[model samples]
Target: MSDHVEEQEMEAEALEAIFDVSFSVVHDAQPFVWSVRLVPVDCGGDESEELEHNHVAVKLVATIPPTYPEDCGPELDVEIERGLAEQHREEILGVARDEADANEGMPAIFAVCEAVRGWLADNNEKGLEDVSMHAQMMRKKKDEERSKAKQEQKFESQKKAEEMTEAELEEIAVRKRRADGTPCTEENFLAWKEQFDKEMEEEAAREVAEREREGGSNKKKGAATEIKSRRDAEREGRPTGYELFSGKAGTMNLEALEAAAEEAEEGSDEDDAVTVEDLDVDENLFDDDDDLDDLDFDDDDCDEEEPEI
Candidate 1:
């Protein structure tokens, strides 16, 4: 046959001669198969001493492929005779696979068998305990990784929500469904509407109280000497005393004048005197952007009526 098949036969014969009773031909067809049983050495005892009471044996089955020892490695399987756990058998098989790969494109069965024998000798004393501990540690590590991945996913979802715009957040909040995906009913809507109206009334009362407090503070600070504040002037739809003199009414104010004088006194003449960066305007004043803030409207000015629930 091929040179690879001839080399395989020679290796099998050598193994049989070497192992004697421990080695046997499993199949002798075109693709040869054989098995060898390995006994662990008593490392602590002399060569002539008998094996320890806890001695264990493993069986290695080698299936020679058509191109073994030339282009690829043989298919190897390992089995423990007794005493040792299955994980130990797997660990020894891994050693055999590594040895086979290291000796590719040459006679490798002897090298793999010797490697396995060395592993058994090295781990003979504590093989079962070590394997059990290793399995437990691996299970714990896998569980921790699973939990960490879930926590990372949750953090990413929260971060995404935080990055959403205010309008997007409000849209999500306005969804008609509950957290569990149930649709809102009329009773639920009515209850929510009542609570929402109550909250709005309370908020309006708080705003009115805040404005009255500010007005009282302004009154205590003499009205003429200091000039009317922007909020009072906006509410009255007229200019302050400073605005009446500067010809910049509705546009400039005391703050802008002070900023401009500071800039000019420090030797600059920029024409844009009132910039957003130079002022701390109240954002609430722009909330209702109707151009007719100067005009007064009664409740009867609106024609649309609220829809009947």
Candidate 2:
């Protein structure tokens, strides 16, 4: 057969097979470029309405060549719906092209169309399953995180309570009950706490002031103890250093010691008198040097012998 005749026969067969498929022309012109939208007719759920509308479907814009498929394959552009992803569109196109190439130069438009329809139906089933499972997983993760946080907070609260003294914990429980607006039925504890809560800061300040007063009283006690200790050391006769050298504190009590000191100083001049022999000097040596030649004097001798009177 001639090349032109064979191509025309292939074109007629391809058109007859796709007669059921709804298609439009390129740019509204009745040209060779065909724009086709294919939707799955029997997808049971939300996608079933696609059979009634052109806007929601897989789209194919193809240019079928006059030459045989052996020399020129159909140029196909596949598009998925707006909300759908492009990766699945590629998968659908790959299956469709494989089907069309298998029946080359023949009525293979239906094969390509059927391949696309199968992909869409599978996508619809798997999409619902995966989406439902993903939502369940997200809810589970959120619940687990919230539960973990609550456990950690509870552990911290328990540790804080354990660290407190028994008395301190009782005080805290009292205050907490008041803050939570509890009823005063429990031994009137709530009413008592309510009265204090109004002046809690001032009460804390008063506690500090009481401690300071106690500290000052302790200092006074320490000073009195020190004074008593010093008086005890003096009574024990620890010399107390010089009896007369004591300052105002010693003199205030040392009347007998001071009188004895006065008596001792009064006799200081006569009682402490020094004779000429005490200095080892000659008494008549100022008369002249009459016995100087007769006396044997040493040059290094500092003391002179006393002459008889």
Q: Where does candidate 1 clash, by residue pair?
A: none
Instruction: Give me the overall lDDT of model 2.
Output: 0.60
Give a tens-digit lDDT track for model 1, residues 1-309: 778778888988898888777789899986888898876653433334535543666889999888887888889999887557777777888999999999988888888999998887655543353456776687567669878999999999999988999999787776844455856899999999999999999999999999999999888787654566655666697666766544354433444645554565456646644445666444554568685477544434333353332
CA lDDT, every prediction?
A: 0.74, 0.60
Q: Which has the greatest lDDT?
A: 1
TM-score of 1: 0.39
lDDT of 2 at 107: 49
Model 2, position 181: C-alpha lDDT score:
88
Model 2 clash pairs are none
Lowest lDDT block of 10, candidate 2: 300-309
What TM-score fits each model? 0.39, 0.33
